[model samples]
Target: MLPRYFYNFSTFMSMFPHNYLIYGADVSIVGATALIIFVLTYFKKWKWLWDNWITTVDHKRIGIMYILAAFAMFFRGGTDGLLMRTQLALPNLHFLSAQHYDEIFTTHGTIMILFMAMPMLIGLINVAVPLQIGARDVAFPYLNAISFWTFFFGAMLFNISFVFGGSPDAGWTSYAPLSELQFDPGPGENYYLLGLQLAGIGTIATGVNFLVTILKMRAPGMTLMKMPQFTWATLITSIIIIFAFPVLTVALALLTIDRLAGAHFFTIAAGGMPMMWVNLFWIWGHPEVYIVILPAFGILSDVISTFSGKKIFGYTAMVVSLAAIAALSFTVWVHHFFTMGAGAAVNSFFGVSTMLIAIPTGVKIFNWLFTMYRGRIRFTTPMLWALAFIPTFVVGGMTGVMLAVAPADYQYHNSYFLVSHFHYVLIGGTVFGAFAGIYYWWPKMFGHKLNERLGRWHVGTFVLFFNMTFFPMYIVGLMGMTRRMYTYPSGLGWTALNLIETIGAFGQGASMMIMAVNIVRSIKFGERDVTGDIWDGRTLEWSTTSPAAEYNFSVLPQVTSVDEWWEEKKRGVVRPDHATFKPIHMPNNSGWPFLIGLSFFIAGFGLVFNWWLSAIVGALGIITFLFLRSFDYNTDHYIPVDEVKRVEAAAGR
Candidate 1:
């Protein structure tokens, strides 16, 4: 009984079977949405939300929004993980159907990597980078807003696929031949393509934005070498993004043409080369591994040094190794597919290049150890995460080396061993580092310290359960449990290990719940950070107020050395006088970015269903907004000195 304009709405609805789980989820989603809308309306806060949040161009506020969205995605992704574990808890379990399993895994990987991890790290970069470098804001404030909204909308498009159409079941990579219309024949894969394309555009813009910000906007006398380690990490990560994301964009665009326009770019029935998709994906994908982890590296460095009460040991070597890793990251993409008969010479070359990454990585590990050797160590929660990263990442790195051997990889490729190594590195390294950074910087972001006792419990359970969950996967992987299998027969000897892993998975989920409780509880009951420098921090971010002002600094700092703020503290230096304050020019907020993101979402959704009319309308909306923005000359204003003085006086600065 659907209308013609429904456009396969019946097909979409039929994809979901009539089941209590689906019904319960539907009810939950509806109730949550209604509750949120009612609360916002009842509080009469829609105007406040629109003015200060939706249309604001402040980097700090935008950063907070990104983190909030990331946390939400994390919950979704984590639930997907738990469901997968529940299905696999015992051999021959039917908790999830094969189709359902594939969709869950696909969404889990995409959401965690693209939506959760990237945004969380980028959010931190946005909130902290300009302050660390003493800039009023990023190089392009308006573009920065566009980056966040595009990412936000893109994530939304990907997430809604499960409920609207079917979710992408071709795996997170969406490899060719399988992902082609001849096989998938649904809107799910299209969601992946367009969603990633939109987010990828935003990611590339973010790279360009931060690159220019770091290079052009540092305080006086802050040379590249004098910058904080985290700033250096941001610079390098941005460069990787600039070079890496375009390949993904091109690959997604080609695949979209194959699906929507019936092209033969990656189709098997024509003059298409399917391997090209794999190559292009890994070319970007390998660098992407570095893209997420490198910032974590930076966060750990800053945290280790701060809690250790010392300058980061071997600073020059750390910078050199980071650059070395970035260069080598581009050269090792071939290692991911050495089993594809690329010849021994090709495999050997890539294998060697891959192992070489371990060298620089080892150098950095040693630097962390040396930094902590003789210093007064603070075993705070952030410090604990940083300290835990050392041993955990070493385990990940060693296993990675094992997988790098091309001859040995034939046995390990696509096996649980590979799965083990991947999670070990990602969770142990990147996820751990993110927690460290969040805890370290929470006060600066929120004007309050998370309860230390609760923080300890959070980190303790997380690290313990994290190890429990992922370590047993190595054993099951060795027992020949290939990933992506929805079910396995009994008597495979995987029952015990799988059961252990499921228990551990739930344990990790419990830890996440604890952390969530800590965050919510700390918001109201947490101790206020009266001092801007809560951790006796070493960076310029701590030089400003706990939750920095609209314009971060009253008088922009003048840098002289590495860890300039710390050095100033040692020398008994004082901040500049209020008499020296000047009128601060800042970018005006714009709604164009928000509107453009909406336009992209609309166009993307239309293209997902091959509805050209909707697509064209959305495209025109985008063009119209861009044209309007190009002619808008009144885009900036200035904060008067008197207003600045009044703000500072309130803060007791």
Candidate 2:
């Protein structure tokens, strides 16, 4: 028997309007124009953006670029959120078609999770790791640039769907049956698959790079135990990405093969089990949440300790709980689909495991609290995000626990409650933490601190509006409003909350605009900051000049304790006074990383078009770039001893 609401691929295609062809043509023209502009700009004397930005492999530069890219994607994703909120504000509103709504949530989730949050975390890791450990650069500087550009190219491919054809309408998870070729034959889904796969390769590359960097690139005397909290988080996050993301790669590949090559990993009539896709996807999906949030945990820890002017509390417990969370996060993905008839035994096991994760998380919360106890807390913007996170995360965690009850999950599954729960955790934890890191490190990254008064506006309005928007989702969810539905009957009593949520969504938009204004003002006209110790920081990061140099530390510090800079300062160790300088070896810029990224973009487009020749060209581009890189052999050149001596002499060291 046919399942309910079945339709063939051709019939499904006929449902959409014919306006897409024009849209695709317009997009192609725009992309071609942009490429021409890029070429013209680089060929002119405005080559600095390409030379200093595109080809430079400095971790700080790369981190800033990652963050700027994420913010751009954030606004793009926010537009999706606003549209979803507007459409759902009133019952039976046809302002947006069901197809459009599907695309909204799909791209919203994709852009936010994969492009915005993940890249922001990568940015944080890139900027902080070398500074915290007193290293000159990441172990693989070229790989760092390659990884970031690769991800950027993938994001470009995903966004290109808007012009060339249409955005993907499958949900972000792109579940099987719904995502199979027969159901979603458009090139949009193909774009999603290829774009994410290309980006996934970059994610894996970054994971390996960070893992090796942390393991091998510490300062002269720093040990594992002495490593900062954020470094530990980066280590664990890298491990999770390395192990968990491959599952997604395999699942995505199988889906692509099923769509393009007629293989039947998920086709219902061909003895393929869609359940395998769900199982495999969630195996990667659940841990992916932790992969993004783990760094936030580290960010909160660092912020708390710095603002509180104390050592981190119960460091051993914090470390152990982090490990526990990483290990346990992988065991609980099945809870996402308890309503799918996974059997009582399986659901019960996953439910219990899911709830167990809360324990380690709770332990972490207490560690932060104790770290802030009775200490002089400055309550900076970063600290504000940290404070807000505690209660907000608890609420989200409570909802998560409520949903973890397998028997009760049947009510909450596929409901807005799940949506609200994740948004709370995601926005409250990861997004807030990312912003906090920005405020905390902006001075160090760029030679100026962000405007504090404007920052207050950004933080205050964002928190207020964010809560107002999402809190009502819980109420509507409890009243039995299901998720992903474009319209509903008026008698459901869901209009008021939805309207309130829409208004809050507008508030979020305004807050983002304010943030943009602050960023712009700070860059062009805001007060200049010359202080090395912006925020009177406690870490070795502050020991270097603000807007740290290409080689982070001229002479690697001999660390003897935690908060090494603080201890040295307390002992009256003045900069340029008892400090000796050494010659620096730094990597030169190369266009190879950019070439690799461009090739991946080409390969992604070829996969989308099923053009073998284009694919071959892309492959050759990549191989040639790699082969040429191997033979260049001029990766590192030394800062001469005389140069080092001159700098030291000038500083009076």
Query: How high is the CA lDDT of each candidate model?
Result: 0.92, 0.87
TM-score of each: 0.98, 0.94
* Model 1, span 400-467: residue lDDT tens: 99999999999889988988898888889998998898898899999998888988998898889888
Whose lDDT is greatest here?
1
The weakest ten consecutive residues by lDDT in model 2 span: 1-10
Off by over 4 Å in 1: 1-7
Worst 10 residues of 1 by lDDT: 1-10
Colliding residue pairs in candidate 1: none
Root-mean-square deviation of every model: 1.5, 4.5
